[model samples]
Target: MSLKVVVVSWGQLTNVVREVQSQLSGEAQIELVEGLFDQQTTLEMARQIEASGQVDVFVSGGGNARMLRHNLQTPVVAVTVSGYDMLKTILQSRTGDETVYFVHFSEIIHELNDLKEVLPFPVNQVALKTPAEGEAFFNELSRQEQPVVIVGASLAWDLARRHGLKAVYVYTPKAVLEALERAVELARVRRQEMEKTQRVQAILDFACDGIIACDQQGIITAFNPAAEMITGISSQGATGRPVGEVVPSLKLEAVISSDRGLFNQLERIKDKEVMVNKVPVIVRGEPRGAVATLHDIVTIQKAEHQIRLKARREGLEAKTTFAEIVGESQIIQQTIAQARQYARSEATILIMGETGTGKELFAQAIHNASQRQGQPFVAINCAAVPENLLESELFGYEEGAFTGARKSGKLGLFELAHGGTMFLDEIGDISQAIQIKLLRFLQQKEIMRVGGQYTIPVDVRVIAATNRDLLAAVREGTFRADLYYRLNVLPLHLPPLRERKEDIPVLLRDMLFKANRALARYAPVIAREILLHLPAYSWPGNVRELQNIAERIMALALTANLSEHQVQELIGMVLQQGAYEETVKIKAGDLSLRAGERKDDLKKEIGNLEKEVILEALRQTRGNKTRAAALLGVSRSTLWRKLREDIS
Candidate 1:
């Protein structure tokens, strides 16, 4: 929308409105009218233009400008007499006289003296407080003996002409154009300010939190919709009233005086609990007002609960696949094929493998490849949790079931794994009481919580894993036979590192990259001789042991090429520490030894160490071989060989 301007002019400056219209034609809509500079005429014309709704501002000059500004509500811009206009009038009325009387309003007379040196003739400035006073000054000047030209404002010029005195009017086209430009610029600024106010009001109305603002005098200036709903007060009755009278619960006067802010403070508004924040509105280092915001506490808590649930659900999702197993050996390939076949069925799977054989890795791969891949893949280790807590962890509990039970109860792993896979690691380690309960769950596909009366059904696939032999436990009456057969519906065994020797190089490279990424450092290039020797040594702890050794070697910079003596020292250092010390008992069964001289030499050294350990155990047992075998964590037959001959 363009700015609309109306210019009211006197007859002396007749061409001013036309000049302003021509200059601001495309920029604004100009309205012109001729009228006397009287209060009645100016007020009537201003009201007529405002009633027509065409003008955003008004422009006039001299007495008419002052009258319009005083009596009209719309803005009135007075055409100012610029310094250039004064200079032009002085030159036009110039005579041989050095002293010319310049008369006008008090404000203009002061400006005339600033340009005194720029004029060719000296000027005597006369200031007037009223039109009558200006006419009296000109009438007295007309009686002078000298014929000095009178340079004055429009009012002064009219009085001088009536008295037959020479005069020049000070209003010029340049002055009129300047006034129009200022009025147009002011109109544009006011329009932008109005638009900004509307946008701020809309935001306040739509905000979710309650908002209320008060001036320093404690008068309510703004109350939003949310504030009305929260405080049980209407904006119509609250605005322009004292804040204490509208809402006595909020003490905004305290905030204004302290010039401080309170954040996330708990408050009760209309008997409903809420979190309130009150801050002082500071402008130019002084407090002018205060704003208070309220948020419902119950609503915030519900939002936080939903976020936690979503995070827990996402944490249980499986991110591994068959391709990430990182092995090419035939035994591993056969195990992967069986796992893939099991993924196509919904039967219970029992994976039997030694420790560190990647049982959980295979379980994750099966879940990711199955039809229920998009659902949760929850896992729990029966051996990791205490026996007293395992039953409740699997079946969940009801509210007030125990002294420390949650007020709202909790969902078990089985319930969380509904329509997905639930991997139970170390299944052989559960107590006899839990075994019966697990068997019932497998048979009926339902579970009863620790204190629940009704059974809850779950649609989950079970995958059980164990390093111990379940058949041996069953023979000893430590495990139930029925439970064993139920969990062994689809049995799969994972090969140990000894059986997958050919995949050591591939596993090493993959583990090195993982270590480098995790540690944020680069691994030195491993020597080819070290790679050859790595496959020869027995990794009793399987793939897990190999990964640990690779990380250790990378961290210690053992891969740097060195002399034969240094290589031997490095080998001895790794053997005496790290994975070797943890799995020394199983090295005999897992390692594949070389023939002839090299095999015999390493075997002799290992044999002497074994004998020394046995003798030390026997001394501790006081020469009882059976107790010594138990102390050494080995079978009696293995101990007998160490006492009689070298074990190779």
Candidate 2:
């Protein structure tokens, strides 16, 4: 850390720098700016050096150093005059014939009389503060002696040289070097102090609590970054103003005047509520200043919410958007329209549908389409988990609450879904004990941990889905009627896939595409009759079953392309696997079967599959005989003859 010392001097003072630099080469760097020892030009030069902001100190001799020190903020070190320097200048400039005059710009060396007695020629000494005094003294001396010796600061020495009189500069190389050493030391100390101040300012700037400091008189001295953020007032506007007037809520004035400090005091800054702490700064048993720290209430709560949800929010998200549900059927379209409207309100939603009717799909869509889309979407299936475990998972549990409780305690699914939506799937299957707790959460918007007493307020939108008949359960005393009413604030019913048969072809095409992509080669092609026949099958598992069937068909198709005949055989196998036997037409004599295989089940499956395929084509053509025959890929007359024959 080499210090930049700008020495603003002319004449002998400027000439001495090279000798001074060689004395101390690496510790300090010196730049000589030739300037006179005066008020105007010298101070202006110092101002320019200070404005550059690279200078550490300004060094000069006599009046210039004094002027710079008095006028500027940057440090200025003066080259001092010693008695030895004076005697040397006087001895060097004199011949026994010429009188020696020593005129100094600073205070005169009081021991000059003693120096006169110690083998120094008779020297007249005087001190001059201004240039006019130096000029008058020089004018008087120029006429008095034909040949004379002059020794003094830059002005006197320079004037004597122009007048053809011998002159010696009083500032020796030793004195100038000493001043440079002082300048270098002062610059190092200031730099270290500045580094310390910057470190403290960095901590204050990044701290969460707003810091405001003031002088004893209550005038603001510092307002950190956090303070500006909380108050919405700039430090430029606040500092140097009275703290009480700038932020009246701080109560800094009272703290400065009194001995007591206020801690955790709630105050209002603009429109926001903030918690404040004010304290008096005391030094040596006397009040020196006051400080206040402000914490915005809303910002604090948001940070706490994030800390609690951080680890639990990883996979708890709603990636299913309204655009993902693919269907153009009127029945499905109506349900979507109603659900979209329901998403706008902050009310509990209860979705009712049969198995595989996409209840969770609709729940996720509503969540993504709502205002809480950016927050977490936590889902839990009530029927899948045991009754006691379900309670702990929904409400959390303190350490030692149960046999396997985590030592650090656990955050509940409801708590993790704070600031967003929570999807409680199979809500009807939960026991009455869990239902009552859910009822409390729905009414008050808060929940208590399993073993903990305090309630935590969770700002979440709850959307519940169930395939069970909740109303029937409530009447039978299995499900609570109060909880049902709470969950059914906004009711939505998703229609089964069979009711929207027109959408089957689209779903089948998408499913086949995905399945075929996984196959990469040798994709199976189903006959056109199988595609048309799908709409007639009473889809017991809805869209989910259709997807499973499509995937299975693709897996089987890797063997060979499946025609209408193969589909009938697959349908027979499919019905037999499911053990469906309502309309059994046992053609036991038909199949060459092993003794272990049942003949009646195969016949019954074939009969049911054939009837559904015939019915699906007729429905798709809207009961028009010719169109139905065309869709079935057969002649109209053959279909008419078959219908008349009662093929069933």
* Best candidate according to TM-score: 1
Looking at model 2, how many pairs of residues clash?
Answer: 0
What lDDT is obtained when candidate 2 is compared to the true structure?
Answer: 0.77
Q: What are the per-model C-alpha RMSD values against the true structure? A: 10.1, 14.2
- Clashes within 3 Å, all models in order: 0, 0
Model 2 misplacement above 4 A: 83-99, 106-122, 128-136, 139-148, 198-208, 232-234, 257-261, 269-272, 283-286, 311-429, 433-648
* lDDT scores in order: 0.77, 0.77
Give the per-residue lDDT of model 1 (tens digit) for 1-648: 778877786656666557545776456877677776455866887898878867788887766778778877778898887777777778878766635778765455567778887776688877677767877787787788778777766666777788888877777777778888888887777667768998989989999888999998989888999988887889999999988888787777689877579999988878989899999989899888899998888877786657755675678877889999988889999999999999999999999987678888999999999999999899987876888889888888888889899876667788888899999998988899999988998999999888888999999999999887899999999899999999999999999887877777677778866666432222222333344445345554577766666665665654445556654556446545433443344344333332233575775656555566667667868999877765554445445545655533
Best by lDDT: 2
Give the per-residue lDDT of model 2 (tens digit) for 43-114.
887798799888888888877777788999988899986777766667777766787777777776668768
Write out the backbone clash pairs for model 2. Answer: none
How close is every model to the real structure, measured as TM-score? Answer: 0.60, 0.52
